[model samples]
Target: MRGWITFAVMSVVTLILLAPIFNIVILSFQGPQTLSGDPVWTVDNFVEIFTQTPVLTYLTNSLLVTLGTTVFGVVIGALAGYPLSRLRNRFARGYSLTLFVVQGLPVIVIVIPLFVVFAAIGLADTLSGVAIIFIAGSMAVTCWMMASYYDSIPYELEEAAWVDGASVFGAFVRIVLRNSYPGILSAAIFSFLVAWNDYLVAVVFLRSESNFTLPIGLQYFFQQNSTDWGPVMAMSVVMLLPPVIIFATLNRYFSIGGIGGAIK
Candidate 1:
């Protein structure tokens, strides 16, 4: 009875999450004839995406920013987390807590200040400037994610390496990192998702038509087309592609061994 109840609950949750996705997929397949009867499948929307819309450009913009954020965020997170792991001081605890607090606050509260600062620096409407904000936004979350995952690692490994005449940096590079590759991959994936799924900051900072990321582009696509659900759904499918690919490739990293090896 308990197992049946759990299964029923899971089924309900899954349907709630997937119903809209299924609707979008079905809408994407609707023939492009003003939502008329013919129930046939077509690639017209996807083709129009590449050939007509500036979607490719938007895709490129999203990719560039997400990759840049992941690269810098992972580097900064790993570096910050490693040292914090070894420190037993009260200041270390306070510092980490402060970063957590800052990161946990709603980004809306700071958007106005960021907008003013960006406008003053001539960064208010550029893709590069928006990427900078994305990097900053993902940093604290990435740092905390990595710090906790790294905390699970054994310290004795680093201590042994240090005793063998390995410099602090060298020991970290050779031993600590070799062991933490999985957690690092997980952190990188999480940061990438955060940057990729962002819509609010992107909509706020991006002004030029040419600078739209996928989310902002989708918004425009929805608003521009009148009674064009097919194209709208197609745009959504395109947006889903990258994160799907990333999530699919992450199967190896989520395994017990991948996480366990990353820590110890």
Candidate 2:
């Protein structure tokens, strides 16, 4: 009886969470009604978004920025995190605490100053500028997350590798990183989502339509008097696909038990 009740509760919660997504999917397929007042279903929304809009360009820009952010965040996070995890010195502790504090601060606080700096440096109005902001904004949390995961890994594994004449960096690459797939994926996803979904930073920094990310490009679907919700939802669906696909593909790689036998 208890198990059945729990299942029922979870089912209700799942429906509640999925209701908005279900509506978006449904609306993406909906079209203008027939003369007889029946609803018309068609793929015209997706077709129109492709043909009539610059959505493909926006998608390409988003992909480039997101991919760049993910790679940089993972590499930098791994390097910074390994040290923080292995060392128990005062500087390491202080740096970790600094990261924690920086993570708590809002991104808006640095927008103006960053804009000024980027403008002077000729990075303004560029996709690369947006990516730089995404990388910097997400750095603190990425470091913290990678460091926490590294903490869970056994340091003795590295010691064993060292005994085999492997350098510290080499042991990190072979043992720590080889077993750190889950952590790497987590940081990548975070960085990807930040770069992909950011509107404020993109809008503030990007002046040309050619460099606009998907989040900013979606606004073109709206007009002065009315909004074309069909295309809006379709573009939103397009925006949703990359993250969904990434999560689905990477879901199997996220296992906590892989490191259990590494020591023995």
Candidate number of the best lDDT: 2
Collision count for each candidate, in order: 0, 0
Per-residue lDDT tens digits for candidate 2, residues 1-264, read 999999999999999999999999988888887899986898999999899899999999999999999899888888998879899999999998998887887778888889999999999999888888899878887898888899988888999999999998999998898888889889989988888889989888998989888988887555521456787888889999999999999888788534866775
lDDT per prediction?
Answer: 0.83, 0.87
Per the 3 Å backbone cut-off, how many clashing residue pairs does candidate 1 have? 0
Model 2 bad stretches (over 4 Å): none
RMSD of 1: 2.5
Candidates in order, TM-scores: namely 0.91, 0.95
What lDDT tens digits, residue by residue, belong to model 1 across residues 98-210? 88888988989988799999999999988888878888888887777777766877777777878889998998888777667677888898889888889999999998879
Question: After superposition on all CA atoms, what RMSD does each candidate show versus the true structure?
Answer: 2.5, 1.6
| Lowest-sum lDDT 10-residue window in model 1 | 255-264
The true-versus-predicted C-alpha distance at residue 58 of model 1, in Å, is: 0.5
